[model samples]
Target: MKSALSAIVLLSLAAPAAAQTPSDWRTPDPENILVVETNKGRIIVEMEPNVAPAHVERYRTLARKGFYDGLEFFRVIEGFMDQTGDPQNNGTGGSDLPDLEAEFPFRRGASVPFVEAAKLPADNAVPQATEVGFVGVVPVRSAPSMQMMISVDGKAPAWGLFCQGVMGAARSNNPNSANSQFFFMRGPYASLDGQYTAWGRVISGQDVVVAIKTGEPVAPPRDVMKSVKVLADIPAAQRPKIQVMDTRGPAFKALIDKARGADGRVDPCAIEIPAKIG
Candidate 1:
């Protein structure tokens, strides 16, 4: 079966220019782009400040300081996530920076652009929230009424989904204990939906993430992030220009229409709108 993207991208391939134009795509900002190179390959992450600004800032600070370079994935749990960024190379370590207050377990109002595209009032199949959609390319789950109960800056409550490649902070039992340690989701974990703060997601090179060396938690001789740099930190000539399929664009609309036309509901995860990097 053709993925929703495969079907639309095939049509886009026939009309390359229309699909390649600026309006149809969004180039991630250098400051917001994270470039991670492991022994396996490069993985690109697009930071989302809208959802968890503090966590994003912490990540940016750590990345700029080269805090993550040479750090091993100290904890890799199969079917859960790959945890890293601990300077001590174990789950016990953290950066000099202070721990961030929990930004979630609260409402993020529905003012986000993608929430509108979610067709919220119609029906959302997501069990975790009344509405579900993408914030850019990052999947999010939220409740419209919860957003209404309490909203910040006209935005409603929405939590980034713990789907494949979702980047989130690894906290102690305390919700606010999140510091430098973070994890990349290897698969879906709906149980984590509203509890953690997800600052970004892998836009490409996810295969490398799936290939991350896995063993017992706290195991040694595991895979490591050989070098981690912000796309802006890298030489301009060497940086990759990443463009995500415009959720607001007609191409995405057609894709959704096709998917919804055939199936009463669309699996948001199955839509597969990947970023195009050049």
Candidate 2:
């Protein structure tokens, strides 16, 4: 009987160890992945077209024309974000493409795959989403339960959250003035919530982004993107197959469980899952 009890303990201990098996990883969708090669290093961004369709379309068109090749990182502010994509090599320049309207407060319904958490996070409350989960390896929050009632059509609203490495369109005084100019967040500032349009976030190489020069928006960037391309648009031989930890997998759930919160509650931004490129 004692030996049987030992066997039970061993099995219990092995369960979690085996949870991190082959099923935990997921290959990213090449269609939405963007690779930006910079003098410092590479930064991978996962585009969320559903969040901002027009912006994604504009970006794809610009990238196809090599509009970002040899572009400078004009505006870089430390402890905030690194802004670029301006053609003038300064804060004021963008593709001839017309400005995209504000896509904030993204409404959602059954169309989107909202991989929701068990409950609302005790930490940050955006007042729109009740729980957060991963959508295509990008951290996204889901609409509150009340909105989920319209789950069949997703007519309700659900906006994406801004964690570290999140990317958004930079605009002028007018919220609809967002053009090709964009920025990468080095830190989290909830004040920007629902103010700017966040279409994607970095899936890898946060260090390279951090290595960029630090200063005010007018400060010149030490390193600039050598080239930027959509993974699908790149030559088949040159394209990279990248994968990230499936946030819906048991491993991710374990990570969520083990993740420590800043105020004794799990801070979603605290968890930074990596993307593997092969």
Candidate 3:
């Protein structure tokens, strides 16, 4: 009896750590994953509707209709991102769906609006008129649309930080022009913020993204999106389970706090330790 009890205790101690590994990882909802096949390679992006529901829904809608298949990367800048999702395969194509309205307000130093009802209303509330800066208002009747641009340089706008492997929609010069073309950030770049509508990020297979070859120099260069498919189209149990670190959770705050000491001094070596430990 004592030996059996000891075995149970040992199992209890080992269970959680075993579950934390990949074997116990939960697969993302099929509806949430996008399989983008590029000429260079395939990129699987996990959509964060929690972050940008309108934009994510639009992308899913387009993907279901087979709108992104056969599209070319169209634009590739080394150390930057590989851009695709153009139905025209020329960096200028969209779905049959009409353009969507811009969701986040274009402002400096502001966050991407939260999705909760209380948060949404508060975000939509008019900022003090005096606080308005370079406002570009579109007619209220327009559909909510977004574009994709991968960061290649420093951080650009305040909407979202351009990290490695972000997925976004593409658009023309018009704020409402994003229809089908999208891009992935290969690296970090800040200059693209206000100019692009960021919708999602890559949750896995980032190595595939980094391996894509660049296109030739031309008026409108071309990389390739070999194909694009929704995860639902694939059989269940074959998909990989990816768990994102909860940015809003205490774990994240603790990480950030440790990055910049209480005095707000950043020690680069401190940041490296976590990656090494992981």
Whole-model lDDT values for every prediction: 0.70, 0.68, 0.47
| lDDT assessment of candidate 2 | 0.68
Q: Over 4 Å off in model 3, which ranges?
A: 1-27, 39-41, 106-158, 216-223, 261-278
Evaluation by lDDT, superior candidate among 2 and 3: 2
Candidate 3 colliding pairs, count: 24
Tens digit of per-residue lDDT, candidate 3, span 253-273: 344355564555432212211
Task: List model 1 lDDT by residue over 81-120, tens digit each.
Answer: 7788888776778888888887774346545555333544
Error of 1 at 182 (Å): 0.8
Which residue pairs in model 1 clash with each other? 107-157, 108-156, 108-157, 109-155, 109-156, 109-157, 110-156
Off by over 4 Å in 1: 1-21, 106-111, 116-129, 145-155, 261-264
**After superposition, candidate 2 runs with Cα above 4 Å error:** 1-19, 121-129, 150-154, 218-221, 260-265
User: Could you estimate the TM-score for every candidate?
Assistant: 0.83, 0.83, 0.62
